[model samples]
Target: MTNKVLNALANNSALLKWIVFLLAAFGFVWSMQLFIAGNAYYSVKNSIEVWQLSPDKASTQKVNSALDKIDNALNYFPNNALFYQIQGQLFEWKAITEANTKNTDSPTTDLTNKVFNLQEAAKSYEKSLKLRPNWSGSWIGLASVKRQQGELDDEFYSYLESANRAGPQDAILHKFIVDFGLQVFSARSFHYVKIKERLKHHLNLGIENPLSRDFVLKTIQKHNANEAVCRWLRDASYPVKKRIPNCITYN
Candidate 1:
């Protein structure tokens, strides 16, 4: 009985030791990957910020360098949603840069690059959404890709609606949707009510913030949306009307 008990104890100790070894090995690998991912994340982040601030000045060579780092990081850490999101932005910027450089000399090649990059951006954004379904920014990125693609307006609006639903109180989102709504306000079809109601929601939300209110008012004036602005703010308070000089003046 003593020998049997000792044998069972030995077997259990051996299993525990193997389990600890495997866990330690996994943890070491994971930490190394995290280190790599963190370095790549900051590099990619700076690249994205530069592109957003001044896409015209962002060189293709630098963007390509960022892509290489991102691809390498993704290989090491495939499931990083933020990496995918930034990758999408990089591709989006590359697409526009390529398109802007288009000329008769290489129009076809530029067009091909634009289409391919935009498609890759869309794919990256979609993957990010799959990983993080509730991320409003990715939804907007997807919508932007659809809009720039300039086909299937309904699909664009659908993604936009998803963004709105995902972040009803997101100030940036409100402004973005409002800006786009006014852009095609006169020409929108099928989704007219949907867009208009969302515009109204954002406008109402905009009234709460001085900066947002001023921006919306100025944007409305810029778009020559006097009638719509006045009508939308019909039940507005005196403070609201005071900010919207154009609305009061036009009416």
Candidate 2:
């Protein structure tokens, strides 16, 4: 009798069909999520490519369009940490745009808009970190936002440290830390350990990408820290070193 019951259950076509239907539904949901995410990422990628080609063309309309798409993606998949990080970046840039075009007649209104956007950026970064605590970019994003707000507390430095720990050799991470590193070089609360090492790493990448050589040297000079920058690049390859003759000549 037990064998008969087993055979009957094994031959249950209705149960098998329900199982197949459930599997297909799960696959469809998963695929649809990826589709939405891909479109959102494409929107971000396209915006960045355009900005790189024509940064002077940055405008409110372009940013708002990107923000709208990302918001729609978040509505469908609220758990994507990367989406939150991207959202944070968009808000941060929007705030920068507001800052660059402050209205003299309505200075208070401009400041308020800038602060509100920055606060929103910070919240998005915090949400991303909560979802995926170890993402180096999100850490950098939060750190950048805090710096913008001029509220660089212990956590701000900690976030930089976290980003450093997460991706020590990442060229992109090196770029961010070097920029922020120069800003707070003399701050009493600044974390000094490994700071120079990261800057050197960035300069090394600048060496490989010679197009960035001038930017690096210019940034270094602007900070009045070319002396230090020259010292860092003293050991880099010879070809790229020649591009920054001012630094490498005496370096």
Candidate 3:
């Protein structure tokens, strides 16, 4: 009886030891997984912080260095569309800096450089559009470059229309289209009444309202107009005959 009791006690001790060993193994595995997950989370967070800081760096040298780091990160994550879009925007800023230096008054002398920089901007914007086709700002930039080149008016208008369709809430596009109409009207040669009539037709103005009145006022202000037209437009109550009669009559 004493031998049987001792055997039973020994068996219980071994069984408890095995249970403890299994529990310890499970705890070790859980701790390791937690450590690995925490490290990965921190690493991804740091990488995103670096990318966010790249564009905000003040100095051009610092910005370029940060951008290089971002570029490497982007390469590692090629599927990230936002990174490509940001790269394209940086290229646009560089191109604008280059183009603004070209003097428009000497178009013949600066034509090559001007066109080259503008084309670079257009390319960057095109790439951005490819990454984000629904982005209206890219289309607007494309249209602006075409307008600057004085070519592709139809195409430019089409792009502008598309931009409007994509982002109808954006009032700036409507303003741009209106300004373009004003520029075209300003370039034409017509008497005040005829000019006003043409603007009303083209701009869809029903009468001599505030916008149409302002358009005529701006036209007189821009051109070397006779004093008569200027005075009348400036103060509509002024008698027309009190000043010079026509644009051709001005010195």
Highest TM-score: which candidate? 2
The sequence of per-residue lDDT tens digits that candidate 3 reaches over residues 70-119 is 46656455544444444444444434443555566876756666566567
Best by lDDT: 1
User: For candidate 3, which ten residues in a row score worst on lDDT?
Assistant: 198-207
Which candidate would rank higher by TM-score, 1 or 2?
2
Candidate 2 ranges beyond 4 A from true positions: 1-11, 49-54, 181-197, 205-231, 239-251
Candidate 2 vs candidate 3, lDDT winner:
2
lDDT of 2 by residue, 4-71 (tens): 99889878977899999999999999899889877987888568545533555667677888899899
In model 3, which regions exceed 4 Å deviation?
1-109, 189-251
Report clashes for each candidate as comma-separated counts. Answer: 0, 0, 0
Backbone clashes in model 3, listed as residue pairs: none
| Tens digit of per-residue lDDT, candidate 1, span 194-244 | 678888778777766653555566567778877877788788776766566
TM per candidate comes to 0.66, 0.74, 0.40
